[model samples]
Target: MKPIVAIGDVHGLEKWRSIVDEHEDCTIVFLGDYLDPYEYITRRQQLDNLRDIIELKKRRMDDVVLLLGNHDLHYFCDRALPGSRYDFQIERFAEAMFNANIELFQYAYQQGNRIFTHAGIQHSWFVDDFKGDLTQPIAHQLNNPESIQFNAMLRLGHARGGRIGKIGGIFWADISELTDPLHGYTQIVGHNRVDDITERCGYNDNKIIFCDCLRNGKYYYEE
Candidate 1:
């Protein structure tokens, strides 16, 4: 099997360039958040970085998988989500770029029992909210959520500042919201920031691996 290398939230960093170049032979999954950089990174730099990523995907379609994160969604979607650090200054440009190449992005990716998403999936959110099918690959359901399912995917749980009882969707789930990983699957996600690549095991030996450590100069890799 080809090796898999998962990159975490970009936040306008250029480190991804080096990582991708180093893993040219591997299947690279970008965990999104390509925009909304820290104050240090200029908006132009952020925009250019995003363009570079899109171009890379265009050049290496077979080897790259881009999963949209909450940050990326605010720019792509019509409705605005409640969150800080949204780059309104460049929204028009970013939105256009995303729409133009939307086909290159998806909500999730899967391989065997491993599923990759921007954020972790909670049990209740999957069973009650998402209403996903266990028999089908998660990516298929998520990438093609129906109107209602699509709205569900935009939910933000309490941890992320949503209503008291709501559970966040795949794109917005916080690490704290995931009390249990989805049954019979290992979820790889990158929305919540962490000090390092972290792993939590749940029922049936299912697991959720948090990889949003790009800010700390870390990434996850496996064969």
Candidate 2:
């Protein structure tokens, strides 16, 4: 199995640097929320940082998998209306990010006969849902350019169940652990801000790891 280093959420550049330095050689899983509500970076600086990170990931071959959290999709859409409710200083940069045709989400490794997804997959979808290898199913169903465009159309608010309840919400879609126990593979997620890791046990025993991030100046998960 490849050594996997999944960073929880990067709201601060310093914390991101720490994770990168600590897990340099491991396959890096950046568990989204790369935008919004961080005082460490100016809105413009945030865009530059995002671009640099994306570039670094490409340079490092396929070592990095960027899984989109709710916040990322919000930023992606905020590019359209600069003064919208969720719009921030990064709006201009959003255009650049979009025009570059960068991807917002990714899946990690499938190892030891089990696959890994960023958010938990619904009971409706899994590796067995595919007719061919895993990649083919993902590309045909969710990861295609047209599919991404469709998924990106709905705003985070609309995607939330509270506003208009449904199982198809992006949060519910990616954060798959909360909905069902993945019977076939281990599904990992990072969105529910738990004080510590939350684990669930069931017939299939799906494991959900809600990793911690930096709060204030302290690294929450560093030990």
In candidate 1, residue 196 scores what lDDT? 97
Q: In candidate 1, which residue pairs clash?
A: none
Q: lDDT values of the candidates?
A: 0.89, 0.50
Clashes in model 2: which pairs?
119-174, 120-176
Least accurate 10 contiguous residues by lDDT in model 2: 214-223
Q: Give lDDT for model 1.
A: 0.89
lDDT of 1 at 10: 95
lDDT (tens digit, per residue) of candidate 1 on 122-179: 8778889989887888879989989999889988888888899898998889888898
- Residues 1-223, model 2: lDDT tens digits: 4577666656535466666777677776776666664454676666666776677677776777776655565555543222123445555576568546465344333444333443444443333232223434332344433434444323233234324433332233434324564454454555555455555655665544555344422222311
Alpha carbon lDDT at 19, candidate 2: 67
Error of 1 at 36 (Å): 0.5
Model number with the top lDDT = 1
